[model samples]
Target: MLFLKLLGAALTLAGTARLGRLLGGRYASRTREIGRWRTALSILATELGFGALVLTQALERMALAVGGHPGGVARRAVALLHEGESSAAAAWRQAVTEASPRCSLTPEDEATLLDLGVYLGATDQEDQLRHLKLAEERMVGSERVARGEQAQRERLLGTLGWITGVLIVLMLL
Candidate 1:
Protein backbone atom coordinates (compact mmCIF):
# COMPACT_ATOMS: atom_id res chain seq x y z
CA MET A 1 0.00 0.00 0.00
CA LEU A 2 2.82 2.38 0.89
CA PHE A 3 4.63 1.58 -2.35
CA LEU A 4 1.44 2.09 -4.31
CA LYS A 5 0.95 5.50 -2.66
CA LEU A 6 4.49 6.54 -3.61
CA LEU A 7 3.91 5.43 -7.20
CA GLY A 8 0.71 7.42 -7.43
CA ALA A 9 2.38 10.53 -6.07
CA ALA A 10 5.28 10.17 -8.48
CA LEU A 11 2.90 9.76 -11.40
CA THR A 12 0.94 12.77 -10.35
CA LEU A 13 4.01 14.92 -10.15
CA ALA A 14 5.31 13.76 -13.50
CA GLY A 15 1.99 14.25 -15.26
CA THR A 16 1.44 17.73 -13.88
CA ALA A 17 4.98 18.75 -14.67
CA ARG A 18 4.63 17.55 -18.26
CA LEU A 19 1.33 19.35 -18.60
CA GLY A 20 2.84 22.53 -17.29
CA ARG A 21 5.73 22.33 -19.69
CA LEU A 22 3.39 21.77 -22.57
CA LEU A 23 1.35 24.82 -21.62
CA GLY A 24 4.45 26.91 -21.19
CA GLY A 25 5.80 25.88 -24.58
CA ARG A 26 2.79 27.47 -26.26
CA TYR A 27 4.12 30.95 -25.47
CA ALA A 28 7.38 30.13 -27.18
CA SER A 29 5.53 28.59 -30.09
CA ARG A 30 3.49 31.76 -30.53
CA THR A 31 6.64 33.83 -30.67
CA ARG A 32 8.27 31.51 -33.20
CA GLU A 33 5.16 31.42 -35.33
CA ILE A 34 5.04 35.21 -35.39
CA GLY A 35 8.65 35.31 -36.50
CA ARG A 36 7.85 32.85 -39.27
CA TRP A 37 5.08 35.10 -40.50
CA ARG A 38 7.39 38.08 -40.50
CA THR A 39 9.95 36.18 -42.56
CA ALA A 40 7.32 34.99 -45.02
CA LEU A 41 6.01 38.55 -45.41
CA SER A 42 9.51 39.80 -46.14
CA ILE A 43 9.85 37.11 -48.79
CA LEU A 44 6.55 38.12 -50.30
CA ALA A 45 7.58 41.76 -50.31
CA THR A 46 10.78 40.93 -52.16
CA GLU A 47 8.95 38.77 -54.66
CA LEU A 48 6.41 41.49 -55.34
CA GLY A 49 8.69 44.51 -55.22
CA PHE A 50 11.71 43.16 -57.09
CA GLY A 51 10.93 39.79 -58.65
CA ALA A 52 8.07 41.28 -60.69
CA LEU A 53 5.75 38.42 -59.84
CA VAL A 54 2.01 38.84 -59.88
CA LEU A 55 0.21 38.49 -56.60
CA THR A 56 -0.73 34.87 -57.14
CA GLN A 57 2.72 33.98 -58.41
CA ALA A 58 4.36 35.79 -55.54
CA LEU A 59 2.18 33.97 -53.04
CA GLU A 60 2.99 30.64 -54.63
CA ARG A 61 6.67 31.42 -54.51
CA MET A 62 6.40 32.60 -50.94
CA ALA A 63 4.65 29.38 -50.02
CA LEU A 64 7.41 27.39 -51.65
CA ALA A 65 10.12 29.39 -49.96
CA VAL A 66 8.71 29.38 -46.47
CA GLY A 67 7.44 26.60 -44.23
CA GLY A 68 5.11 26.14 -41.25
CA HIS A 69 1.87 28.01 -40.64
CA PRO A 70 2.85 31.05 -42.68
CA GLY A 71 3.68 28.87 -45.66
CA GLY A 72 0.47 27.00 -45.18
CA VAL A 73 -1.47 30.25 -45.29
CA ALA A 74 0.22 31.32 -48.51
CA ARG A 75 -0.38 27.95 -50.10
CA ARG A 76 -4.00 27.96 -49.12
CA ALA A 77 -4.47 31.45 -50.49
CA VAL A 78 -2.97 30.41 -53.78
CA ALA A 79 -5.22 27.38 -53.93
CA LEU A 80 -8.22 29.53 -53.22
CA LEU A 81 -7.23 31.90 -55.96
CA HIS A 82 -6.91 29.04 -58.43
CA GLU A 83 -10.30 27.80 -57.38
CA GLY A 84 -11.96 31.06 -58.47
CA GLU A 85 -12.07 32.83 -55.15
CA SER A 86 -12.91 36.06 -57.04
CA SER A 87 -10.05 38.24 -55.77
CA ALA A 88 -6.66 38.04 -54.16
CA ALA A 89 -7.97 39.88 -51.12
CA ALA A 90 -10.79 37.36 -50.71
CA ALA A 91 -8.46 34.44 -51.03
CA TRP A 92 -6.04 35.91 -48.56
CA ARG A 93 -8.76 36.63 -46.06
CA GLN A 94 -10.18 33.15 -46.38
CA ALA A 95 -6.80 31.50 -46.08
CA VAL A 96 -5.84 33.51 -43.03
CA THR A 97 -9.20 32.79 -41.43
CA GLU A 98 -8.82 29.07 -42.01
CA ALA A 99 -5.23 28.90 -40.81
CA SER A 100 -5.69 31.13 -37.79
CA PRO A 101 -7.40 28.46 -35.72
CA ARG A 102 -4.61 25.94 -36.17
CA CYS A 103 -1.83 28.46 -35.58
CA SER A 104 -0.58 30.08 -32.40
CA LEU A 105 -1.51 33.56 -33.59
CA THR A 106 -3.39 35.74 -31.22
CA PRO A 107 -6.62 37.39 -32.35
CA GLU A 108 -4.65 40.60 -32.87
CA ASP A 109 -2.17 38.80 -35.06
CA GLU A 110 -4.96 37.28 -37.07
CA ALA A 111 -6.58 40.67 -37.44
CA THR A 112 -3.33 42.18 -38.64
CA LEU A 113 -3.01 39.53 -41.32
CA LEU A 114 -6.58 40.03 -42.38
CA ASP A 115 -6.04 43.75 -42.62
CA LEU A 116 -3.02 43.19 -44.84
CA GLY A 117 -5.12 40.97 -47.07
CA VAL A 118 -7.51 43.81 -47.81
CA TYR A 119 -4.92 45.76 -49.83
CA LEU A 120 -3.31 42.78 -51.51
CA GLY A 121 -3.41 42.91 -55.29
CA ALA A 122 -5.97 45.69 -55.13
CA THR A 123 -3.52 48.48 -55.71
CA ASP A 124 -0.40 49.36 -57.68
CA GLN A 125 2.89 47.61 -57.00
CA GLU A 126 4.18 50.36 -54.79
CA ASP A 127 1.05 50.35 -52.66
CA GLN A 128 1.15 46.59 -52.35
CA LEU A 129 4.76 46.77 -51.22
CA ARG A 130 3.86 49.47 -48.73
CA HIS A 131 1.09 47.32 -47.24
CA LEU A 132 3.44 44.38 -46.94
CA LYS A 133 5.98 46.57 -45.16
CA LEU A 134 3.36 47.81 -42.76
CA ALA A 135 2.23 44.30 -41.96
CA GLU A 136 5.81 43.27 -41.33
CA GLU A 137 6.22 46.10 -38.90
CA ARG A 138 3.12 45.05 -37.00
CA MET A 139 4.39 41.49 -36.93
CA VAL A 140 7.67 42.69 -35.49
CA GLY A 141 5.80 44.35 -32.66
CA SER A 142 3.74 41.23 -32.04
CA GLU A 143 6.84 39.04 -32.03
CA ARG A 144 8.43 41.26 -29.48
CA VAL A 145 5.41 41.06 -27.18
CA ALA A 146 5.16 37.31 -27.65
CA ARG A 147 8.86 36.89 -26.86
CA GLY A 148 8.41 38.87 -23.68
CA GLU A 149 5.44 36.77 -22.61
CA GLN A 150 7.28 33.56 -23.44
CA ALA A 151 10.24 34.58 -21.35
CA GLN A 152 8.14 35.44 -18.33
CA ARG A 153 5.38 32.83 -18.53
CA GLU A 154 7.16 29.70 -19.66
CA ARG A 155 9.36 29.20 -16.60
CA LEU A 156 6.66 30.36 -14.25
CA LEU A 157 4.21 27.82 -15.54
CA GLY A 158 6.79 25.05 -15.37
CA THR A 159 7.57 25.85 -11.75
CA LEU A 160 3.92 26.24 -10.90
CA GLY A 161 3.24 22.79 -12.27
CA TRP A 162 5.72 21.25 -9.91
CA ILE A 163 4.41 23.31 -7.01
CA THR A 164 0.84 22.30 -7.75
CA GLY A 165 1.87 18.68 -7.97
CA VAL A 166 3.55 18.92 -4.58
CA LEU A 167 0.47 20.46 -3.07
CA ILE A 168 -1.70 17.73 -4.49
CA VAL A 169 0.64 15.05 -3.23
CA LEU A 170 0.67 16.58 0.24
CA MET A 171 -3.10 16.74 0.31
CA LEU A 172 -3.31 13.10 -0.69
CA LEU A 173 -0.79 12.16 1.97
Candidate 2:
Protein backbone atom coordinates (compact mmCIF):
# COMPACT_ATOMS: atom_id res chain seq x y z
CA MET A 1 0.00 0.00 0.00
CA LEU A 2 2.82 2.43 0.92
CA PHE A 3 4.69 1.58 -2.26
CA LEU A 4 1.60 2.17 -4.35
CA LYS A 5 1.03 5.54 -2.70
CA LEU A 6 4.63 6.59 -3.36
CA LEU A 7 4.33 5.53 -6.99
CA GLY A 8 1.15 7.51 -7.37
CA ALA A 9 2.72 10.62 -5.90
CA ALA A 10 5.76 10.28 -8.12
CA LEU A 11 3.59 9.94 -11.19
CA THR A 12 1.56 12.98 -10.25
CA LEU A 13 4.65 15.15 -9.89
CA ALA A 14 6.20 13.92 -13.09
CA GLY A 15 3.04 14.38 -15.10
CA THR A 16 2.37 17.88 -13.85
CA ALA A 17 5.96 18.92 -14.38
CA ARG A 18 5.90 17.62 -17.91
CA LEU A 19 2.66 19.42 -18.61
CA GLY A 20 4.05 22.68 -17.24
CA ARG A 21 7.18 22.41 -19.34
CA LEU A 22 5.15 21.73 -22.44
CA LEU A 23 2.98 24.75 -21.83
CA GLY A 24 5.98 26.94 -21.15
CA GLY A 25 7.71 25.65 -24.24
CA ARG A 26 4.94 27.05 -26.42
CA TYR A 27 6.00 30.62 -25.64
CA ALA A 28 9.58 29.84 -26.58
CA SER A 29 8.41 28.12 -29.74
CA ARG A 30 6.27 31.10 -30.72
CA THR A 31 9.24 33.44 -30.47
CA ARG A 32 11.44 31.07 -32.46
CA GLU A 33 8.75 30.57 -35.09
CA ILE A 34 8.38 34.32 -35.53
CA GLY A 35 12.11 34.69 -35.93
CA ARG A 36 12.12 31.95 -38.55
CA TRP A 37 9.36 33.72 -40.46
CA ARG A 38 11.35 36.94 -40.41
CA THR A 39 14.43 35.19 -41.75
CA ALA A 40 12.50 33.29 -44.43
CA LEU A 41 10.65 36.42 -45.47
CA SER A 42 13.93 38.27 -45.82
CA ILE A 43 15.22 35.52 -48.06
CA LEU A 44 12.05 35.65 -50.14
CA ALA A 45 12.25 39.42 -50.36
CA THR A 46 15.84 39.26 -51.56
CA GLU A 47 14.95 36.61 -54.09
CA LEU A 48 12.09 38.71 -55.39
CA GLY A 49 13.71 42.14 -55.33
CA PHE A 50 17.41 41.64 -55.99
CA GLY A 51 17.64 38.13 -57.39
CA ALA A 52 14.89 39.04 -59.87
CA LEU A 53 13.15 35.78 -59.21
CA VAL A 54 9.47 35.12 -59.72
CA LEU A 55 7.17 34.35 -56.82
CA THR A 56 7.29 30.60 -57.34
CA GLN A 57 11.08 30.42 -57.56
CA ALA A 58 11.50 32.73 -54.59
CA LEU A 59 9.17 30.61 -52.48
CA GLU A 60 10.97 27.43 -53.50
CA ARG A 61 14.28 28.90 -52.44
CA MET A 62 12.79 30.21 -49.22
CA ALA A 63 11.40 26.80 -48.40
CA LEU A 64 14.80 25.29 -49.00
CA ALA A 65 16.59 27.86 -46.87
CA VAL A 66 14.28 27.85 -43.88
CA GLY A 67 13.11 24.89 -41.86
CA GLY A 68 10.33 24.24 -39.32
CA HIS A 69 6.80 25.56 -39.56
CA PRO A 70 7.80 28.68 -41.52
CA GLY A 71 9.47 26.53 -44.14
CA GLY A 72 6.43 24.32 -44.16
CA VAL A 73 4.29 27.33 -44.96
CA ALA A 74 6.45 28.27 -47.93
CA ARG A 75 6.53 24.71 -49.21
CA ARG A 76 2.77 24.41 -48.94
CA ALA A 77 2.31 27.67 -50.82
CA VAL A 78 4.64 26.52 -53.57
CA ALA A 79 2.81 23.23 -53.85
CA LEU A 80 -0.51 24.98 -54.05
CA LEU A 81 0.83 27.27 -56.76
CA HIS A 82 2.16 24.39 -58.84
CA GLU A 83 -1.13 22.58 -58.44
CA GLY A 84 -2.88 25.28 -60.50
CA GLU A 85 -3.74 27.66 -57.73
CA SER A 86 -4.78 30.92 -59.37
CA SER A 87 -2.60 33.40 -57.55
CA ALA A 88 0.33 33.62 -55.16
CA ALA A 89 -1.78 35.69 -52.81
CA ALA A 90 -4.48 33.05 -52.57
CA ALA A 91 -1.95 30.28 -52.18
CA TRP A 92 -0.19 32.14 -49.41
CA ARG A 93 -3.46 32.83 -47.59
CA GLN A 94 -4.44 29.19 -47.75
CA ALA A 95 -1.03 28.07 -46.62
CA VAL A 96 -1.07 30.38 -43.63
CA THR A 97 -4.58 29.31 -42.71
CA GLU A 98 -3.75 25.63 -42.89
CA ALA A 99 -0.50 26.05 -40.98
CA SER A 100 -1.99 28.22 -38.23
CA PRO A 101 -3.48 25.42 -36.14
CA ARG A 102 -0.21 23.54 -36.18
CA CYS A 103 1.92 26.53 -35.29
CA SER A 104 2.40 28.76 -32.28
CA LEU A 105 1.33 31.84 -34.20
CA THR A 106 -1.36 34.01 -32.70
CA PRO A 107 -4.29 35.30 -34.70
CA GLU A 108 -2.52 38.63 -35.15
CA ASP A 109 0.56 36.86 -36.44
CA GLU A 110 -1.54 34.87 -38.87
CA ALA A 111 -3.30 38.05 -39.96
CA THR A 112 0.01 39.77 -40.62
CA LEU A 113 1.17 36.91 -42.79
CA LEU A 114 -2.18 36.81 -44.58
CA ASP A 115 -2.03 40.54 -45.21
CA LEU A 116 1.48 40.22 -46.60
CA GLY A 117 0.29 37.39 -48.82
CA VAL A 118 -2.43 39.62 -50.21
CA TYR A 119 0.22 41.88 -51.71
CA LEU A 120 2.46 39.16 -53.10
CA GLY A 121 2.51 38.83 -56.87
CA ALA A 122 -0.31 41.36 -57.02
CA THR A 123 1.90 44.38 -57.43
CA ASP A 124 5.22 45.64 -58.77
CA GLN A 125 8.59 44.75 -57.29
CA GLU A 126 8.84 47.89 -55.20
CA ASP A 127 5.37 47.41 -53.69
CA GLN A 128 6.09 43.80 -52.94
CA LEU A 129 9.30 44.75 -51.22
CA ARG A 130 7.46 47.32 -49.14
CA HIS A 131 4.91 44.77 -48.04
CA LEU A 132 7.61 42.27 -47.15
CA LYS A 133 9.37 44.94 -45.15
CA LEU A 134 6.13 45.66 -43.32
CA ALA A 135 5.63 41.98 -42.57
CA GLU A 136 9.18 41.71 -41.27
CA GLU A 137 8.58 44.62 -38.97
CA ARG A 138 5.44 43.05 -37.61
CA MET A 139 7.30 39.79 -37.04
CA VAL A 140 10.01 41.62 -35.15
CA GLY A 141 7.42 43.19 -32.89
CA SER A 142 5.68 39.89 -32.32
CA GLU A 143 8.96 38.18 -31.49
CA ARG A 144 9.78 40.85 -28.98
CA VAL A 145 6.40 40.49 -27.30
CA ALA A 146 6.77 36.70 -27.22
CA ARG A 147 10.24 36.92 -25.74
CA GLY A 148 8.97 39.22 -23.03
CA GLU A 149 6.34 36.73 -21.98
CA GLN A 150 8.33 33.54 -22.25
CA ALA A 151 10.63 33.70 -19.24
CA GLN A 152 8.04 34.97 -16.78
CA ARG A 153 5.32 32.67 -17.95
CA GLU A 154 7.55 29.66 -18.04
CA ARG A 155 8.82 30.16 -14.52
CA LEU A 156 5.39 30.90 -13.10
CA LEU A 157 3.69 27.99 -14.73
CA GLY A 158 6.49 25.57 -13.97
CA THR A 159 6.44 26.49 -10.32
CA LEU A 160 2.66 26.40 -10.18
CA GLY A 161 2.60 22.91 -11.62
CA TRP A 162 4.91 21.50 -8.96
CA ILE A 163 3.04 23.32 -6.21
CA THR A 164 -0.25 21.96 -7.40
CA GLY A 165 1.14 18.47 -7.49
CA VAL A 166 2.41 18.75 -3.93
CA LEU A 167 -0.89 20.16 -2.73
CA ILE A 168 -2.75 17.32 -4.32
CA VAL A 169 -0.45 14.72 -2.79
CA LEU A 170 -0.84 16.30 0.64
CA MET A 171 -4.60 16.36 0.36
CA LEU A 172 -4.64 12.72 -0.64
CA LEU A 173 -2.38 11.78 2.23
RMSD of each: 1.0, 1.1
Backbone clash pairs in model 1 (N, Cα, C under 3 Å; residues 3+ apart or in different chains), count: 0
Whole-model Cα lDDT of every candidate shown, in order: 0.92, 0.90
Q: What is the lDDT for 27 in model 2?
A: 93
Q: If candidate 1 were superposed on the true structure by all CA atoms, what would the RMSD be? A: 1.0
In TM-score terms, which candidate is top?
Answer: 1
- Runs of candidate 2 exceeding 4 Å displacement: none
lDDT per residue (tens digit) for residues 85-126 in model 1: 368888889899988779899999999999999998889999
Give candidate 2's error at residue 76 in angstroms. 1.5
Task: Give the CA lDDT, 0 to 100, for residue 5 in model 2.
Answer: 99
Each candidate structure's count of clashing pairs:
0, 0
What's each prediction's TM-score?
Answer: 0.97, 0.95
Which stretch of 10 consecutive residues in model 1 shows the poorest summed lDDT?
80-89
Candidate 2 has an lDDT of 0.90
